[model samples]
Target: MQAVDVQDYARRLMEAHGDKAVAEAAQKARALEEKGKHEDAQPWRRIEAALKEMLGPHQS
Candidate 1:
């Protein structure tokens, strides 16, 4: 998806679940990464990365 789509999804997800969604997703992604399961972590990692990328370095 495009940056715009990522931005929209992040916004909507935040609105629906507050900060918990992003926080939990990031946590899950990290757990996977630490286990060397990058492929399995992709979905969560991508969303977290996209949100951060779209929001910039100071986002979180």
Candidate 2:
């Protein structure tokens, strides 16, 4: 997905899930990866990164 799409997804996920959004994205990525769905996992990884960026470095 594009950067803007990822950011939009991240924001919506954050609004819905709050602080758990990042972890949720990471978990989705990892699950896809473990299932040998690397391509599918990419977007989730991007979303995770976007969420992390939105949360800032000070967050756990």
lDDT of each: 0.72, 0.94
Off by over 4 Å in 2: none
**Each model's TM-score?**
0.52, 0.92
Give lDDT for model 1. 0.72
**What tens-digit string does per-residue lDDT give for candidate 1 at 1-60?**
566776677777667766576786699889999999989887776677766654556635
Q: Considering summed lDDT, which 10 consecutive residues are worst modelled in model 1?
A: 51-60
Q: Model 1, 29: alpha-carbon shift in Å? A: 0.3
Return the top candidate by TM-score.
2
lDDT of each residue in 1-60, candidate 2, tens digit only: 888899999999999999999999999999999999999999999999889888888935
Backbone clash pairs in model 2 (N, Cα, C under 3 Å; residues 3+ apart or in different chains), count: 0
